[model samples]
Target: MTTVPPFQRALEAHGDAVWRYLRGMVGAGAADDCFQETFLAALRAYPRLHRESNLRAWLLTIAHRKAIDHLRRRRRDALEPLGEEIEAKPQGDGAIWSAVATLPPRQRAAVLLRYGGDLAHREIAAAIGCSEEAARRSLHEGLKRLRETL
Candidate 1:
């Protein structure tokens, strides 16, 4: 059997979180494709990884960028309309998935990372390629928008 590299191990370990993050970014249908692309990109760039510390954050960062690129490539002018079944379920604040779909990309990502993947501000910053303060601001702004919508 081939020995798994540390990076590979880390990728396997955190795959679910990365998938969840992508799902929130692109929705459930595209999540797996984005996840595969994220890991493939990671493998191509694996030689450059300098440290094991915060591997989850590192993987998430790659996943975030890949998700963004995937979205860009699709050239979607607006958020996809939510299906009726998904739209009917009430979110925590009695909002629906359609409301969540209306957020801007950055705020949506922050909200997804915070609530969907349960990442801290620091980790979210690493993933979103922003400062911790910025991550916090994004999350706060997202929540505020969600509150207003609901």
Candidate 2:
């Protein structure tokens, strides 16, 4: 069997996760652009990737950074107010997704990474470019805020 390049293998493995992360970051509307940008950036940086043990985490880290960058740039340009509320049920109770969605970007990212993506604290920290402690704090604060809304 022909061997797949590391970069290609990484893309195949993590593409959906990265896209999901981007969707949570930028909403579904702009997710495609952010996804493209993320992989493009990854393709450029793939040669410098020295670790093969945790390619999923590495690719997620890049995607997270790209999503943040995209959000920053979008904020600078014409920005639209967040539209509509998303309703979610936690522990079988209905809650407004808008309430949780109101969290600051980093906290939202942390929460989404944890609950939505089923990632561990370390993985969330890697994706958000923060310390594991910071990621934990964000998740804690997000859950606290969400509870208040509930």
Least well predicted 10-residue stretch by lDDT in candidate 2: 85-94
Q: What is the TM-score of each predicted model, taking all chains together?
A: 0.75, 0.76
- Compared with the true structure, all predictions reach lDDT values of 0.75, 0.72
**C-alpha RMSD for every candidate:** 4.1, 4.3
Off by over 4 Å in 2: 1-6, 84-100
lDDT of 1: 0.75
Residue-level lDDT of model 2, residues 52-106, one tens digit each, is: 4466676677777777787788778957643331232132322445555577888
lDDT tens readout by residue for model 1, 1-150: 243366668776888788767766776667789888888888877777665456677778888898788778655654455333235545553243556667788888899888767788989988888899999999999889988987
- After aligning candidate 2 to the native by TM-score, how far in Å is the CA of 122 from where it should be? 2.3
5, model 2: CA deviation in Å?
Answer: 4.3
Which consecutive 10 residues in model 1 have the weakest lDDT in total?
78-87
Say which candidate scores most in lDDT.
Answer: 1
